[model samples]
Target chain A: MELFQNLAQGFAVALTLTNLLLAVSGCFLGTVIGSLPGLGPSNGVAILIPLAFTLGLDATEALVLMTSVYYGAMYGGRISSILLNIPGDEPALMTTLDGYPMARKGRPGDALVLSGVASFFGALLATIGLMLLAPILAGIAYLFGPPEYFALYLLAFCTLGGLASKNQAKSALAAAIGLGIAMIGLDNSTGLPRFTYGEIHLFDGIDFLVAIVGLFAVSEIFIFIESHGKKSAIGVTLRKVTIPIKDIIHCLPTMLRSTLVGFVAGVLPGAGASLGSFLAYMAEKSIARDKSKFGHGNPRGVAAPEAGNNAAAGGALVPMLTLGVPGSGTTAVLLALLLTLNITPGPLLFQDRPEVVWGLIAALLIANFVLLIMNVPLVRLFVSILSVPPNILLPGIMMVSFAGIYSLSGSGFDLILMILFGLLGYLCRKVGVPTVPIILGILLGNKMEDALRDAMVISNGEISYLFSSGISIGLWVAAIVGFVLPIFLRPFLKTPPRPAD
Target chain B: MTSDRIFGLAVLAVALFYLYSATAIQLGFLSDPVGSRTFPYLIGAVAALCGIYICIKPDPDPNWPAWPIIAKLAAATAVMYVFARLLKPMGFILPAAVASALLSYLISPNVKVSIIAGICLSLGLYLIFRAALGLSLSPFGDLF
Candidate 1:
């Protein structure tokens, strides 16, 4: 009942002309950006975060705008996948297998519509799960002691810094570096300044924004320069556009089932949307009587991954909102932003910040419609947008980035940091070290300390309290399972079981 | 052939750094129970162990960036320095446009249109953030 009332309030906020316009613009802008092969959601979010900040909306409103862009990007990614056999990002790679086939078959419009509806249904179902699960988690969270929190924070470090990347050692190295950097400020518990090294800026600690932008945005551009000098190959035909109702009905059961699969994968600490898409795609293909047609324009093939990816996006939010644990890379960036807003997301988040959470839910529901409407008719425009010459397009993006950095602050130092970080980021990618966990390490680094301190305070100086609690034990059980499941499940990954009868 | 082992050893070396720094921090008795550096110490130990394992048995890696590409990127770092050093004196639009053009050149010099696009985009940015959104352009004090 409270969820319903809160939802209604969110709707009231969402329906206002300002938010509606923002949602519509975000969706339109998102699809345009996403249609470009290399300008993925991460780049979109990184570039736009400062702009979103400059708008100075209250935290909820800012979140609403960005979340809208997120769903919009999901809608937009398929355009490139269908037109050009290249996916814009990892999550969309599954879409390309069947989507490009449909384009070759002169049914690109059907592919677009089916993908949109699948994204909507999957996101809607997962949002329902989030609405129910978040409140319950928040309620249970009220009872957690400091030691429990401390252990949970350790779990975040272990899961991300230890388990996420290919090399646990390097991940641990990144985590250590982040922790060492985090320790630069004056110690809160003790008034003694540590590691300030006589610089005023060091007293504030190294800004994760600096690390994140340097590592992600700039490095990405450098990699693009080296790897792809030509237009990211894509098709751009505005063929007859409108998928049939029967086709959508046929994919409905697949969407619902895949949503559940995606949501479950989303709940696990490390396995994110890529795993969700792989599971959903193979599951649908396995169950189909016509399994042989999967890679060759089977409509169900496109529906399954689209549904899985969108649902995973909604599902990934649950851990972040409920426990301050981010299940994926982009969400990790959002977690960092949430901290900068002075909003610590945990169990108390639901009680304290209903507007931010609920408004987001409200905005997501409306955002799907925004994406749907934008996708169905205007997809032709978005498809045509892919034709922009990379020469002009790449420079344009670089210019906008330079201007944004310049306008945000007159600080020449940040510009240097951005370029330096960009180069480092490119190197990290080349080395096969995932960038997401580093962001997660930076985001979670400080809080783990706070949780540890609280746990110590209550334990009367006994470190064993972390292992002593029932909740702590349960969390560890889950974390251990999460940590090892990926390794154990590696064999089954390529060929996920067909939907069980 | 031995780079794999060396890489693993490098990881271990990082871990040792963490362990040394983290454990070195002193936590006083009871009054300030959870003093600063306690969490860092814990993470430091975990990193050190992981590092030691890698040092003992390193995984083989085949692919590395080409030496020439790495050198070219190193040279591009000089361009970034110029962008920062000159952004204000040259005005937001001009310095930004030129800096962006140089960065785009790093992507490819064959695409002549990217530079033109860079100039137009830089000017557009001057209009949007400076003229429209009312953010202060990187101010040119006497350098202009």
Candidate 2:
């Protein structure tokens, strides 16, 4: 009953003219950005952060707009996957396996419409799960002390390395580098600077927003430059638009099962959309009557991953909103947005800023419906975006990044900082070191540090205090298992087929 | 000899410097029992250990691009640096236009299209940021 009341209040806020307009535009822009190869939701959201800030939107408006974009990108990722055999982002990789094969079989329109419906189904169910789960989780979080939070953060870092990167050592190194970067500004407890080198700009610390834009958006430009705008796959033309009602009905069970798998994967600390999609596909494959047809343009293949990844995307937001911890790379970016808006996301957020939380939920609900309605007729429009040449596209993205960053801070130094981070991001990519951990480190470092300090103060510097609480002990055990299990499991886990470059 | 080894060694050097710097952070009188330096020390140690691990077990092969592609990437990076430097002195438009043109041309070596696209992007972004978004940015400056 209370949930109903809260949701009704949320709807009132979301139905406002300005919020509705922002949601629609954000969905449109996110779809266009996500259709581009390699620019996933993280970069899509990162590129648009400056615009959101420049517009001077309030907390609710900004959250609504960004989450809409996040949902839109998930929907849009399948476009390039089916049309060009290029997964638009990492999460979309599994989609390409079945999506592209289905397209090659000449029912491109049917493949696309089916995936879109699957995505809608997965995302809608997961959003409802988030609405129910988040409050209960928040209620539990009220019991957490400093030790529990520190252990939880440790769990985040430990689990993230195992899931996010191919090499654990490199991922750990990236997290360390991020923490090192985070240590640059003035210490919160002590007034002394850690690594400022006497630069005045280092007083407030390296802005994660700048780091995000530099790493995700600017480094993308460098990658594009290196490739010289060459893409080999010719897009499959959508000759006719047809609603695949029969296919939808057949895949409904697959979508339902995959959504369950994906939502669980998403709710976990570090298992994100990529894992969600991969696990969903694998789960469906194991249970199929004929495994031979699984990868050979089966409609279930398209439906499974589409449902799984979208559900995982919604699931990732659960930890981010309730516990102030992000479950995925993109959620880490959203975490940064919430921090920048001066909103501390945790148990208190529900009590203090119910409107912001509830309104965002309502907006996401609306945005999913908007995406379903908009994607079918606009399929032709989004597919055309794939043909946009890198020359024009790269420069245009760069200009938006530059103008946007400059507008936010009006500081030339941040621009330089952005470029340096860009170089760092490029190097990390070249060396197969994931950049997401670095962003996560920067985002969570201070909070993690604060939690540790608070725990120490409470326990008079006894190291055992960190392990004293039941929650803390459980988190520590979970962290150890999460980090170690992946190593042994690596051989057994089915590697998803890589999209042809 | 591998690129991973080189990268690992670079990380090791950074960790060492960061450790040394951690030792140098001045403590305030009202510091907590844990203090600020403890976290930095812990981070430094973790970084050092990771660096050593990476150095000992390097990836077999790192796929680096050709020298020309590397050079082009460097050039684009340089343009961005210059764009940052010139943004304030010359205003957003001039620097943005020039950087956009140079980057576009580098992406696809067509001079005419690059310049037109550059000018149009700079102007168009100016309108979006300044006019539509109501953000502050100078169109032209006194530097020129």
Candidate 3:
């Protein structure tokens, strides 16, 4: 009953005119962008970040808009996976196995419907998990100190670097590079400038919003140019959106199991949705009674991975909100947004900002229903958006980005710097160096430095003071595992025939 | 092997960059332990060590170096420089529209498509940034 009241309160906040408008816009745009190949959820968040920041939106409004896009994109990604045999992000990779086969078998419409239903179920379960887990974790988060936070951030970066494919060294190098970038701007303690190079613009530090635009959005344009904006398999028009009831019933158990698996993967600090989806797909294949049907046009195969990925996306949010640590690159982008809002996450957050917490929760619930209803009937709308031709779309997105940045700062220099960063972002990505750690490094570097310095000051420069509590020690261990285990685990972790894009 | 060595060499060069910055940064008086130089220097040293490891034990090859990275970087830099020159002189939207259109040429297969794409893109951006958002962009420059 109390849950009902809280949800109602959350709904009241989320259903405001401004939020509803932004949510709808975000959902529609998210679906279009996600349906396009080579653009993933992180890229979506990163590209649209400037709009969110410069729109004069409140934290909750900005978050709701972006998060809607985040989940909405997850829903839209299956379109290409089934129809084109391409997954935009790693999370959508597993959907291709059965989805594409289903498409080839002349039931592209059914496959699309199944994917939407499975994703809806998976995301719902995960959001419910988020609603339950976040408050409990927030309660525990209250006990965390500067030491604990420092350790948690360390663990997150380490774990993320660890998980990168065969390129762990470069990933580690990327983290180091990220930390350095994070160090740029002014140091908080002595009012000292760390790496600003005497530039006043950076005195307040590099804006993650600008960085996101440059990295994800700007880089995406360069990539499209490389492919000349040509899509090999144009999406097919679907006659209908609903699958037979038996299809949904057939995939029910697989969906449920994958949701659980995905949620678990998401809750962990660094495990991304791609891993969750792939793992779920593998598990479904292993457990199937009709094993021979595993790879070619199996409804269960389509359901498990698509469901798992969506669920994992929701799960990844738990740690990002309750803890300052993000579970994936996209969540890392959201983490940057949280800092801009001045709403420090961790245990005290729920107590201090119950409305933001509950409102986000409630809005997601609404967004899920919005996604399902809009997804099926409007499926062709999203595909049609893909046919808009990148020649038009790519240039247009660029213009918006530049104009938006110009409007936000009203300073030509900021705009110039934004483009510079955009180029730099393009280069780094092409080099296969991860961009999130850099953003995380820049965004969290100051906070981490502040925490470290304060902890040292409080402890009179004794490094050992960082491990004063059991929780802190455990966190440190987690960080080490995050950094080290991925290197050893890489050889053992199964590499899919083709890695998810 | 070629990409591996290149990456390894790139790593080493970056390590050197870090080291160079560490050594060059002025470490003022010792009153502040964490100075402009301390963190960079620490990072420089650690990065160099890692660079050494990478150089010695670089992984096997992935593929031909993604050559498009160079073209993309060049185009982006050109766009940035073009915008900087235009923003104050030409104003925001017109120069932006032109530059964006030029950028479209960089993306689209044909020049005709690029121009058309660029114009439409500039229009949507104008709506979102100037009108709906009520942002003040440079409106009076003569770059156009």
Candidate 4:
């Protein structure tokens, strides 16, 4: 009843004319950003956060807009994956495994529709789950102490870092690098700079936005430059977009299953939408009667990952809202946005700032419906975005990223740092290191350190405190299982593991 | 590939430097039972270990881009670096325009089109940020 009351209150806030309009605009903008190669959901949200602030939207409204963009980007990413064989983002990478081949078979429209439907279902199911689960999770999370929280974060690291890449050591290295990046500013406990190296700007630490812009957006620019204006051969059949009733019926199970898989993965820290989609794709391939049908143009392939990743996007919000830890890179960026508005996310957020939390949930539900409606009829418009030459698009992205960052900090020094991070990001990609872990490390690093120190201080410097509670013990076991289980599962999986995106 | 191996070793070197730096951080005050250096040291050690492992056994050969592609990448980085350096002194429009135009030109070698695009994008962004959003972006001074 309380949850229903909260939901009603949330709907009341979210249904306002301004909030609804912002949601629609966010979805539209998100689609554009997401459909464009080299700019994904994270980039869209990061670029827009400052803009949203500049619009003078209150915290809840800003979040609603940003989250709508987040959902829209998820929907938009599928378009390029299906049509261009280039994934708009990491989660969409798996969509390309099946979606692209299907498109190339001259059924681009069908592929788009199937994936769109799948994304709709994924987001829908996940939102419903969030409505039911978030409050309980937050209530439970309220009881977590420093050690338990540390264990939980460690669990996230082990699960995400371990399952994400083929090589555990490499993922761990990426995580360490992220933590290193996070340690750049003044120590919260001591007030002494850890890695400032005598620079005034370094005192505040590397801005996550600067790092994300360089890592995701700027590095993408370098990639686009390397691509040298080459265009994808768009499948020209231009058939009317239609999914047969039979095909939808066939993919229904796959979509539902992947939604579940994606939601669970999204709720876990470190295991992001990419993992969810990948797992769902693999699961579908393994269970299908004709495993060979996958990757060759199976509708299920398109459906599975689309549903999984979108559902995971919703699931990813759970930990972020309930526990104040992000399950993925985009959510981490979202967390930064919330922190900017002094809206600290944690268990208390539900009680103290119910409007912001419930309003976001209500807005997201409406946004997903809007995206589903918009994507079906306007799919062609998004595909046409592919025709825009890289020259124009890249320059626009650069200007936007530059202006966004400059507006936020107004410190050109931050822009310089953004470039350095950009270069570092490019090099990391070249070397096969997963950048998500690094971003997660930076986002979670300070908090992880704080929790560890608090646990130690509580137990008078005894390491045993970290392992004392049942919750802590359970987390450690889960972490170890999360780390080791994937290696064993690797052989049974029929699909070749995608290289870390 | 030799490139990957070299990268691994380079990472090891950086990790070593990081570890050294971690040790160098002064233990300012005992604000917590475990000092700030502990986490950094752990990360440095883990990173160093990973670097060593990677160096000993690098992944399969990565396809290194040709010299031309590398040049393009370098150019892109340089353009961004210059844009950042010039952002405050020259203001947002000039550096953004130049960078955009230069980057666009690199992608498609048309000077006029690139310049027009650059100007359009800079001005458009200027209007959006300054006029629409009310964020004070300097055309030529420290905004702060």
Number of backbone collisions per candidate, in order?
3, 0, 6, 0
lDDT per residue as tens, model 3, A395-498: 66676667666666666777677676666666565556666676677667767766776676677778898999999999899888777776777666764563
Q: Can you write out model 4's per-residue Cα lDDT over A374-425, one digit (the tens) per residue?
A: 8887887777886777788888888888888887888888888888887887
**For each of the candidates, what fraction of the native contacts does it recover?**
0.46, 0.83, 0.39, 0.83
TM-score of chain A of 3: 0.93
Q: Give all TM-scores, in the order shown.
A: 0.91, 0.98, 0.92, 0.95
| Tens-digit lDDT string for candidate 1 (A254-300) | 99989899888776555566667777898888889978888888889
- Which regions of candidate 1 are displaced past 4 Å? A157-174, A229-238, A402-409, A495-501, B1-6, B18-31, B55-62, B88-90, B139-142
Docking class of 2: high
- Predictions' DockQ, in order: 0.48, 0.81, 0.46, 0.73
- Sorted on lDDT, highest at the top, how do the candidates line up? 2, 4, 3, 1
Candidate 2 CA-lDDT value: 0.89
TM-score per model for chain B alone? 0.71, 0.94, 0.73, 0.88
Error of 3 at B42 (Å): 3.9
Q: How would you order the candidates by TM-score, starting with the best?
A: 2, 4, 3, 1
Which residue pairs show backbone clashes in model 4?
A: none
lDDT of 3 by residue, B1-144 (tens): 555567667777877876675565554454343445555666666666666666777665543225674566477568867876677777766776777778766665477776666665666666666777666665657644
- Please tell me which predicted candidate would have the highest DockQ against the true structure: 2
Better by DockQ, candidate 3 or 2: 2
lDDT for A109 (candidate 4): 87
Candidate that would win on lDDT? 2
Q: Which stretches of candidate 3 lie over 4 Å from their true place?
A: A229-231, A234-237, A498-501, B23-38, B61-73, B139-144
Q: Which stretches of candidate 4 lie over 4 Å from their true place?
A: A229-239, A491-501, B29-31, B140-144
Candidates 1 and 2, the one with greater lDDT: 2
